[model samples]
Every structure is written in structure tokens, then in C-alpha cells.
Target chain A: MQQIDASAIDAVGIPRLLLMEHAGLAVVRAVHHLVPDPSAPLVICCGTGWNGGDGLAAARHLHERGHPLRVAVTGPLDRLREEPAAYARILRGLGVAPVECLTAEALGPLDEWLAECRLVIDALLGIGARGAVREPAASMIERINRSGKPVVAVDIPSGLDADTGRIQGVAVRATMTVTFGLAKRGCLLAEGPAHTGTLVVDPITIPRRLLETAAA
Target chain B: MSIHSSLRTPTGVTASLRNVLKRFERVRHLMTQGAWPEGRSVYGLPKIKQVKLKVRKAAAKEKEEAPAEAPATGAAPSSSSS
Candidate 1:
């Protein structure tokens, strides 16, 4: 899947930023489909990777459209990679400061946000995540599960093994999973369907040719 | 393997190798049973006992249990007579 995404970006000449934007838009669309009222509060939990960047982009879109939003990031802003950092900067410029919760102690406010919000966007982990889930993200997943708020997992649920459909230590039980490009194999594998509810596959504008070539 | 570890799904397929229920499954089961009500925290869910029912197979061997007065219908010819 990474190879296909790379080919789409590098060979097909689609800008990486465009992919992020499209993915973010797709998530927002799913959110609207679930909860049409724009004023409903929602929170996006993000990791410090492209997945987080997608969350930031979604935050921007949601904020622009006047949806009550809170964005929490797992790590410091400086540690964010280039693309995510760029989105982070844009978000900050829009006065949407993302809460950085690096430690379990810092997650207190996250609990309040989870309790207050109507939906959760789990951008904390993507298809690249493997093995047992570690701190902060693990804690966030637990909180999300306990909150009982319907969650819309970005790409795939955090802590879910995208290839094996196995739960790595713990995984978020999302009410709906809005996956981009294609449906990940893990979403259909063992214990995958139980955790992944109402799976929605949205194209992120990866060329059909690239997808076909990868499948072939 | 313990009976719990070899639990089967509704279709009679083995559910998983582990006897313990996944947290998600446990929580969902609790909710369905009304043990975990909505608005309650999901932490510290009560333990669910895995019930192992003793399935007794019905008495078998109709051929061996055939009545003494039964006709030898469709029975193979005796090789001793040949």
C-alpha cells in the first residue's frame, strides 16, 4: 500500500499535500454523514506522522465549516514530520492550537474533551503501525473506548495490525472507519470486523491505474 | 487444551486459541447483558465466566442395537455360507 501511495505521489506526480487534503476531506465527509449538525462537538486525536497531518487537515476543514472541534496530538509540535508540521502551522495560524499530550498525566484534559465531544477521529495511528501499542496512544485508545462516543477511525483504527487484523495489545472500537485509497486487509482479517464497524472506503485520488497495477 | 481455550463460534468453528475474551468483546458482551450500562466507564469490567457445557452424545450404533427379531434387510450375504 505504501508502494502504491509512493508511486501515486512520486511517479504519477500527485502532490503529497493533495493526498492529505483529499484524505482529510474524505474524513470530514464521513463525519457529516454520521452527524449532520455542524455545531456538534468533535475531537481528533492525532499521532506525529502523516496520519496526524491528515487530522490537522480535517481540523482545518471542520473549523472552517464551523464545527465545534478540539485537536489533540500525541507528541510535541516540533517532532512532527514536514507535511504534518506544515498542517500544524496552518492550524496554529488559524488559532486552533493543538493540545500536545505526551504523557499519561497530560491526558486529563483529553478525558474531558472525549466526554464533551460527540465523535472521535482516531488519527493517532495508521496502516504503518505494528506490534503492541505503546503509551499515550494506547491510553487515548482506552479513553476513547471508555467514552462510548462513536469514533471514526482514520485510515484504520489505532493499534490495529493493518496486515493481520490482530489487535496489538489494545485497539479502538470505532463505530465507523473511513479508510482512504483502499480498504486495508487488516479491517477484514481476524477480529478486524468486530473492531471495525461500518467500514467506508473513500478514494484519495490515487490514480485508478496505480491501484490496478498494485492489485495486479 | 482446556475447554475454554477450545471454545467454538456459533458455526462450530474454533473462536481463537486464547481462552480470555478480548477487552472489546468483553465490554460489548457486558453491554448486551446490561452489566455495563451506557454512560458508565468501561474500565474495570466484571469478569465473565466462560461456561463449558458437558455435551453428551446420544446413544449410538443402530447396527449393534438392532432388535433380535429384526429382519436382515439389505444385509450382505454371509461369506461362511458361500
Candidate 2:
């Protein structure tokens, strides 16, 4: 079987947060396609990296479309470094209040909120965090699944290693995963295909030439 | 058509339309013998229409004269009253 590694696209530097914006847009469109006139609520789980940025962007689009939305972040808002922070700020501007899940205690209420939602967007981790899941995020992933609403993985399932598509013990069972930039290797191989559900590729604005060279 | 009762015809038509469409989809799926049948996944390599054949075989084998055996002991419904 042919296998591609996450390292192949490691150096493919997209503009600061452009990739995240596109990821958010793709998710919003896909959700609309599945439930055109949605009647239930929407819950988006955000992390502290570019993946979180993707969720924040998705929240904005979903809110504008008149879908009831709830945004939850795995860690503290203050700890969100750079791009994700900016994306959070944008969501704030769009009138979305971010709920932080910092401890196990928070999981119950988050689970309750998730239960009321029709769809859950799993942006807790990106392809970059390709190893064992750590801390609150792992528990958050468990709770998201237990809610039983359909999950849409942001880039890859949280706690899932993008390199080998290995689940580092903890992982999100997404019903559909919208991959960013050239379809990550893990999205096609190992247990990745099963855990990811349906794979939808969204190549965020990396120039074709640059993608070819960097991938080469 | 007037909103009083004439419009009810369209409503009835649409309800029947929905039923027809649903039945058509089920029949289409049953005929295809695709990846999933009756909401259950059909694992492994595609084979000939074995499921339908199996059902037919079981039905044919179960055709023992049990009903005749039951009525033979004078338990048949009395038709003299009719």
C-alpha cells in the first residue's frame, strides 16, 4: 500500500492564518450541504493552535448562516498563542462567546451543551500534534463522542498522529474529517480512514508551484 | 384550486408521492444488492445474489404440511353453520 508522511507537507508555509480561514469555510459549506436547513444547534470544539483558528472561523460562518452555534475551547483563552488567538478575537467580534474547558469538571456542562447541538466540529488538534493526546483535550474528545452528535474533524482527529495515522491512545471518532492541504498521508492510511469517517480534502491557498517543490 | 377542499388533492398527492418515492428507493436498493442491505453492511468481496436465494431456500424448506396436520384432528372450523 502507498503511504505518504506528514513531513512531506511540513515546510509548506501558507500565509499566517489563510489556511485556517479556508478550512473554516470548507467545513461550513460541507455542513450546509448535509443539513441545508438545519433545525438543531451547532457545537464547535476549538484547541489552542491553527486547528482552533479553523474552528473560530467556522463559528463565524455558521453564526452568519443563522445556525445556533456554541464554541468551546479545550484550554485557556489566554494560552492560545498567536494565530488562534487572533481567530478567537474575530469570533468574539462576531458575538460568539468562547467557553473554556480547562478541567474534567467542565466536561459535564460541555457535554450537556454538545448534546443540545445537532453537529459538533472537532478542531481540538491539527495534523501538527501527531502524538499521544495530552491533558484536557483528551477528555474533551471523549465527551464530544459520548454526546453522540456527528463529529467533523478539523484537520485530523485530535490525539491522532498525522505521520502514521496512529491513535496515541486517545482520538476523536469523527463522522467526517475535512483535511487541509493536499490530503495528509494519515487521512488515507492505517486506522485513519476508519476514525476519520468520510475524508474531504481542502487545500488552503498554497501556490501549486510551492506545494510541488516543498512536497518534492 | 380553492383553498377550501380543492387544495387537499395536492396535499394527498404529495403524501402519496413521498410514499412512492420511499418505496422506489427501497426497491432500487434491494435490486442493487449493494454494499449495504437492510441497513446492514455487506462485508467482503461482492458475490452473486446469495441473500435473496437463501431466503427463498429457507421458505421452500419450511413448507411442511403443518396446517393440514393441525386440522386433521377434527379441529377444523365448522362450516355447517354457514
Candidate 3:
């Protein structure tokens, strides 16, 4: 899968930003499908990687569509990766304030956001993340799970290994998941299926040739 | 006598010896002879017994052909009669 994405970006000349833009759009589509009510409040929990960027992008689209939504960043804006950071900057430009939960203690606001939101979008982690769930994000995941609200995981559930589906500490139990390109190995193995709920594979405009090569 | 007969080919002759053994067969031979040292890597080991294969000349080829030709002639008559 890594090979395919690299080939698509480097060899095929498809922009990474374009891929991320499509991903964000796909997530918004899923949200619209599940919750038709435009006014329903939604919370998007984002990390510092491309996954977070997808969530941030989704927040922007949701905002433009006049959906009442709140976004919480697991870490500070400065810690966000280049791609996700771009989206963060765009959100700021649009005057959409995303709560930055830098420390475990700072995650207190996320509770109220999760409690009132109609649906939660989990973009805290992507396939590239490794090891166990750490502070802030860990507590945030715990809150989302305990909130009992339907969750739409962007790629794979946070804290769930993308390749092994092994939960190092805690993982979100999503009501539905919008996985990009293809279903990750973690989504089908171990406790993945149980945590994943209704799994949806969103191509997100990855080249057909690249997807076939990776599948082969 | 029995041991020599066991080595007979389908044409009723002693099986020809190969000139060389493959690397794995050489290693197995070394292991059986207790010449292979423990904890020693299998790579770049010493060569073992190598028999020089006897290249059959005109006399051997003629002998092989005589039996093969006799069987073909014999089978033809029987097959035709049947």
C-alpha cells in the first residue's frame, strides 16, 4: 500500500494535497449519508498527521455547508505535519477555531464537545502511526468511546495497528469507518472488525493501476 | 554377486558412476563420514571423493545397440503376429 501511494505521488505525478482533499470530501459524504440533518452538531478529533489534515479538511467542508461542528486537535498546531498543518492553517483562515489539546489535562474540553455532538469523526491516527496510544490522544479516545455517540473513523481507528489490528492500549469503537484506498490489514484482523463496526472502503481517487498493483 | 546385480541398469549393465556430486550431496557425505565439524558453516567446504566417469567408446555403444536392436526386432514379430 505504501508502494502504491508513493508511486501515485512520485511516479504518477498526483499531488498529495489532491489525495488529501479527496479524502476529506469522502469523509464529508459519509457524514452526510449517516446524518442527513445539516444542523446536527459533530465533533472531529484530529491528530498531527495526514489523517488529522483529512479531519481538518472535513471540518472546513462541514462548516461551509453550515453544519454545527467542533474540531479538537490532539496536539498543538505547531506539532502538526506539513500536510495536516496546511489544513489547520486553512481552518484558521476561515475563522474556525479548533481546540488544541496539548496536554492530557487540556483534553477536558473534549468531553463537552463529545457529549453534545451527534457524531464523532476519529482522525487522531493513520496507518503510519506505531506503538501504543500515548497521553492526550489516549484520554481523548477514552472519552469518545465512553460518549456512546456514533463515530466515523477516517482511516483506521486510533490506537489500532494498521498492519496488525492489535490495540496497544485503547482504541475507538467506531460506528462506521471510511477507510481510504483499501481496507487496512488491521481492519480485518484481531479486534479490528469489532471496533470498526460498518466498514466502508473509500478509494479517495488513488490511481486504478496503483491499487491493482498493490492488490496483486 | 547380489550386490553387484543390484547396481545393474535396465539394459543389464553396471550403473555408470557420476564424475561429481552436488554440493548438498557432498555435505551429506561429509556429515556421514563425521568429517564435518560442529558449528562449522556449510559454505566453502573441502572437496570429497570424486570418481572419474568412464566415457563409453565405440565398443560400449555397439554393445548397448545390440541389445536394444534385438528387443525391437523381437517385439515387432510378436506384435505383428498378434
Which model scores highest in lDDT?
1
Best by TM-score: 1
Q: What is the C-alpha lDDT profile of model 3 across A1-216, one tens digit per residue?
A: 667778889999988888899999998998998998899999999998888999998998998888887889988898887888888888888888888888899887788888888999999988888898998889989999999999999989998998767896999999888988877767765678778887788888898877766665
Each model's Cα RMSD: 14.4, 10.2, 19.8
Candidate 3 lDDT score relative to the true structure: 0.83
lDDT of 3 by residue, B17-79 (tens): 443654445556786888866534434658765565556786799898899888887788788
Task: State the interface C-alpha RMSD of candidate 3.
Answer: 18.6
**Stretches > 4 Å off in candidate 2:** A1-14, A214-216, B1-82
Worst 10 residues of 2 chain A by lDDT: A1-10
Q: What is the interface RMSD of candidate 2, in Å?
A: 15.6
Give the DockQ of candidate 1: 0.02
lDDT by residue for model 2 (A129-164), tens: 855787788888888878888888887888787766
Best-to-worst ranking by TM-score: 1, 3, 2
Q: How well is candidate 2 docked (DockQ)?
A: 0.03
Candidates' C-alpha lDDT: 0.84, 0.72, 0.83
For each candidate, what's the DockQ? 0.02, 0.03, 0.01
Q: Is candidate 2 or candidate 3 better by DockQ?
A: 2
TM-score of each candidate? 0.72, 0.66, 0.71
Between candidates 1 and 3, which one is better according to DockQ? 1
